[model samples]
Target chain A: MMVSQRPSEVSTSAHERVYRTLRSRIMYGEIAPGQALTLRGIGREFEVSMTPARESVRRLVAEGALFLSSSGRVSTPELSNERIEELAALRALIEVELASRALPRAHMALIDRLQGINMTVAEMISKRDAVGYIRANLEFHRALYLRAQAPAMLAMAETVWLQMGPTMRALYGRLRRTEPPRNHKLIIAALKAGDEPGLRLAVRSDVTQGLRMLAG
Target chain B: MMVSQRPSEVSTSAHERVYRTLRSRIMYGEIAPGQALTLRGIGREFEVSMTPARESVRRLVAEGALFLSSSGRVSTPELSNERIEELAALRALIEVELASRALPRAHMALIDRLQGINMTVAEMISKRDAVGYIRANLEFHRALYLRAQAPAMLAMAETVWLQMGPTMRALYGRLRRTEPPRNHKLIIAALKAGDEPGLRLAVRSDVTQGLRMLAG
Candidate 1:
């Protein structure tokens, strides 16, 4: 999720800094699932004490972005198939509402911006840059949801994205697609036409189509 | 807001136990908004050390159920009107989908159980017991959403509840009503008729109406 702050290595508290850095990496699918992590390793990598590393790990665990064992071992989550399906359904239900809400506010400038982002997504696909593709795809949706003028709803939707991150990386890695995101085109067209229902359908279709590949 | 576990007073680690208890109380609206909390006070209340108390507070803060000031003081959240509206919209979006998914699985016995819970909600309202009413009303929603077999969706809906708990307590306390939950009856009727659209509308109305009272 956005977590409301950029990671500043300069002045924030150690744990807060670690929390933001780890949160962003997880939300953007930089981490792989089931990868074991230790407080010592995190402390070493971030050049912080173990206390802050442990606290940051605890914070991420609270956000459902990471898993912690009873013995205090921590790892990126390996979501079950059932959990994956539910998150996909949630994305469909919420993003459709967000896109519909944004429809009245979407102007040509916004549409042009989305098209630019879509091009970056296409570039990522061609370059086989998984993280870049994930970042650009989220940027496209974030740009849309921002117009909804609903921060709470946007934050919740982004949390679902955070939870889906590692698994999405796996899903995308397994299914290589040559085509650009056709559903994004539909989203842009619906916006241009100010079609609320069409926008909802396009958003839902885009979310579900990508997810169904994992399910199948 | 169930957090899928009961608050255990024994055997578990002190922090885990404290987290579960505080989570349940906050989720159930047992705490009031703007209620200032200190780590020292929590340690005393739960008869635990400051370490566990601090850890639990950190977890709740991470979950958005509690707010922490820059000075590190903690308090139950007092939501703004706009935030409340967004959460209500979220509820309508997610719960309607959950109810629709549950419809085919909602047997007569399930419907009967909901009727029983609704009766308890009515009783609590009549008794002018705000917390009891909130708990029963949530139980009513929970019992129905449980049948959806969508754990992740249910968990998301419950987090909205957790975030709203204090505000909901404050809202219901101000608006005393003589009638039972009328929209709930419509929900039951729609469920019985197997009308998906009716069910969605009923659920949406039920979710929106209670929240609108606070909005007004």
Candidate 2:
């Protein structure tokens, strides 16, 4: 007998399945910066043909989540300090606006949801799981931003996040922090208080602070 | 004997050539919003096989320059009013920052080049050439932003431009202006006076003023 599958899983196309899974892995810092990927290897790993594999890579490359070299090699980007700073600034610009838009709509349930995600972020930190930490942290921010009803802005912010993922992994190794980011608490408090400027500042600081150290 | 070709043209891959040409067409509003494109049609037009055409389409879709429906139709996006506003806000945020960053680096030569581009923009507007006007307008903004030395930020800004391309064509038709945007002159004045805040305001106004009306 066939095993039951989730409705979403059942509806996903093979190429889309491969694309979503690979995109998450890269975006969560499961892949290291400058790591190379081969179409043959990806096809074998995902149990798909080269066409789907190539399409996924092309999509990721277009999103700036992957880099394609002149020699026809595909790899995660190894961003320079300047590039890192620019991406971080973009995150600050976009995410701060997202947070500000989300402020008036930030109900008790959303704040609670953010708090719950923050706990997961702390748990990942304590467990020393860098990828999990990054994923949870993003979830926390995304949960807040979702209330903004600004899909285009959120997408832009996520693209910046995807571009920074590998570098964030590298930074996680260098950081070795025992606590979660303090800015998350500030963000939550600002949201609860309905403080737009505070929320914007907190969001900007939360997004840019860590990356600034790396850029420096 | 084979006709002479440009070195850049000779070096471009089949897919890259197709991708670049198609990207420009879409970005310049040569295509209407909600216009459908078939792979077979694209392949015939470009004299290429299905693979390169598919690749180019996939890349554009990922960049938000095109949309892919669940039924497997590919078309230029017909953006909603809300989406248009969000994208305009994004342009204001990023382009203003880019202009501010580029200010100190804007030499007299660059200002002259910008004026020359503004002339072309006016010429296109007077001729009622929507595509040419869009292309020249982008060139003027891009020439200024290139001095920012922030590729990642610029790429994000360009993606927003790509998404707005078709909508911009519609706006151009509605506008039917006899004069260029007044904000362009303000931008030039601010740059000449080395006024940072003035430069930011001008850039933000220039990018968002036209689109705000469409969204409204």
Per-candidate Cα lDDT values, in order, are: 0.88, 0.90
Report the lDDT of model 2 for residue B200: 94
Model 1 misplaced stretches (Cα beyond 4 Å) = A1-10, B1-10
lDDT at position B157, candidate 1: 94
For model 1, residues B1-216, the per-residue Cα lDDT tens digits are 433243664567788988988888888788999999998998899777687788888888877899998777899998988888899999999999999999999999999999999999999989989889889988999999999999889989988888988888888888867799998999999999999999999999999887778757
Extract clashing residue pairs from model 2: none
* Per-prediction TM-score to the true structure, in the order listed: 0.92, 0.95
TM-score of the second chain in candidate 1? 0.92
Best by lDDT: 2
Interface RMSD of each: 1.2, 0.4
lDDT for predicted candidate 2 compared with the true structure = 0.90
Candidate 2 chain A, poorest ten consecutive residues by summed lDDT: A1-10
**What are the runs in model 2 whose C-alpha is more than 4 Å off?**
A1-10, B1-10
Worst 10 residues of 1 chain B by lDDT: B1-10
Task: Estimate the lDDT of model 1.
Answer: 0.88
- Tens-digit lDDT string for candidate 2 (A94-164): 99999999999999999889899999999988998889999999999899999999999999999999999
